[model samples]
Target: MSKRLYVGNLNFSTTHETLQTVFGEFGTVITCTMPTDRETGLPRGFAFVDYATSKEAEAAICSLDGKIIDGRPLRVIEHQERAGRDHFGPGGGGGGGRGGRDRF
Candidate 1:
């Protein structure tokens, strides 16, 4: 079965098509995607690549991880499921607070 990997520290200029092309050297790329910001629509400096098989994914990671691309080293690893964090602070993560005060 195909396996997916998380590719971090990617150049902002990196594209899904480019990723597929680059990683294709290792094996068949099922899919490639670069996460982007919703507001600015900018790359999040990371991406995910799905390979045709786990062995291919491993080979890609071994060959591409820490490899230079766009002048930066790539970080490749098995993709992990995301778990929502408790972004809420003491009151909340919104940073709502009183006026500035010099409290000792």
Candidate 2:
């Protein structure tokens, strides 16, 4: 099955195409994405790379993790799906402050 990897500690200058080129050495890179700031539109210093197979992803993790690129060590690992929870805070609960329904 296809696998995704979280690539962290990327240089701000790193581009999606650069990630593809780097990771492509291991296997087919299905997709590469580097999120940018909503307002500044600058790289978020990380990326996500999708490989055609888990083996390829594993190979990438083993070979690329801790490797320096653009003067920053890369942190490559299998992407773990985050657990479903509240968007606000812990215990999936929120909005219990002075401005809430208890306000006089």
Q: Best candidate per TM-score, number?
A: 2
State the lDDT of candidate 2 residue by residue for 1-71, as single tens digits: 89999999999988787898999999999999999999999999999999999999999999999999989
lDDT on C-alpha atoms for all candidate structures: 0.89, 0.92
Maximum-lDDT candidate:
2
Colliding residue pairs in candidate 1 = none
Look at candidate 2 and give me any clashing residue pairs: none
Count of backbone collisions within predicted model 1: 0
Q: List the RMSD of every prediction in angstroms.
A: 3.5, 4.2
Writing each residue's lDDT as its tens digit, candidate 1 over 4-83 gives 99999988887777788889999989888888899999999999899999999999999999999988899999999876
Over the full model, what C-alpha lDDT does candidate 1 score relative to the true structure? 0.89
lDDT of 2 at 64: 100
